[model samples]
Target: MDANEDLSPRVMDANEDLSPRVGMEFDTLKDAWEFWLKFGRQMGFDARKHYINKNMNDEKITSKGFVCAKQGIRGPEKENMIRTRNQDDTRTNCPVKLYVSLVREIGKFKVIDFIEEHNHTLHLSETIYMMRSQRKISKVHARLIELASSSRIKPKATHKLMSREACGRTNLGFVELDQYNYLRTKQQKNLIYGQAICLLGYFQEQLTTNPSFQYAVQLDNVK
Candidate 1:
């Protein structure tokens, strides 16, 4: 009946639900936080704990907020320190956020506010897993890394194998550098353990040769 009404574009609230929305309820604060984290991962950003408000009477959680990891800039006092150190501060004061409050009647947490706008560039989907909070060495990945190292396979080769098994690098959830770091840490642990074992063996041999052989180990301040 009306040309303007007929020409109006269809609505797109689907994507809004894809992210967090106001009045969204969760059974627990953890659920809300995890949901927000999932939303951040999907949106190519990282999230951080923002604030928590508790009821003064019962000391129960009244509200909670999760914000973009890059939400705040370095303060003025830190400006000289940062410049003196010749290091860059990554914070941009991005406003992207999710906040929820406890609903007494429903006994759930409801999202009171949601902001999707970000002042900084979001991470690319392909390399999003490389984010510090996202990258982790799982048990399976650790076993594979150990097996590969034991078999004398290179770190890069092991990473490729993991990518192939997961069908893509994104699915693998860690970059090649992570694999190298993990190997380095494992090697350090092995070296320390080997040193302790060698010392123990030497002590055992001394005791066998002379039952009264006495030795004392003195540790430095670091220990």
Candidate 2:
């Protein structure tokens, strides 16, 4: 029950189908044990001090006090190279593996709470759609301005007089004409209108959980 002790046995029975190979070599139990001990020491886990001297008590994974080796299971790298590969594309394994990876990279306490908080709900598809749509709308707005300015054939006489006078005072009329020219482009106007509608929709979706309102539960508060 030592915290550092292999919890694989508790999690997996002797006759369990899943067999975890330590690394690239050593398929047998004795070899695997020796390799693990040696590797642990090399990676800075002292067997005599960690296991023997400390006389560490059984510490389950759920307990906040427990601490284990940062190195957890590696994916295909841990499998025996010589054995014919019977690769199982484990769907359940993905989240757990990600969780462990996050815990090791970040800290276990924060990650555990993050998982618990986000366990049941996280609208990934909706989030992605929102991001994509927002990008598309921004692109449309830029294109509209570019196209409108390009379509300007000639300037009005009044615009020329105003432009000359304004040039002495920082050319405000010329700048306004340039903007008007861009805004008059047919393609630009069309794109602007289209993007505006899309943006409205995205904002409507965001408004559901936008601080004051709540349509779905927010995961940010969990951590």
Instruction: List per-prediction Cα lDDT, in the order shown.
Output: 0.80, 0.32
1-223 per-residue lDDT for model 1 (tens digits):
2323221111224545555778779999988876776677777787789999999999999999889998888888787788889986667899988889999988999988988889888889776776655666776677779998999999888899888876887777678998899999999989998998899889989989999998877765965
Q: How far is candidate 1 from the true structure (C-alpha RMSD, Å)?
A: 12.1
TM-score quality measure for candidate 1: 0.63
- Give the lowest summed-lDDT range of ten residues in model 2: 93-102
TM-score each candidate. Answer: 0.63, 0.15
Q: Residue 221 in candidate 2 has what lDDT?
A: 62
Q: Mark the regions of model 2 whose C-alpha exceeds 4 Å error after superposition.
A: 1-155, 167-181, 184-190, 193-223
Compared to the true structure, candidate 2 yields what TM-score?
0.15
* Top-scoring candidate (lDDT): 1
Clash count for candidate 1 is 0
Error of 1 at 191 (Å): 7.3
Which candidate tops TM-score? 1
- As a whole number from 0 to 100, the lDDT of residue 144 in candidate 2 is 36
In candidate 1, position 107 carries an lDDT of 91
Runs with alpha carbons beyond 4 Å of true place in candidate 1: 1-16, 53-62, 75-89, 181-223
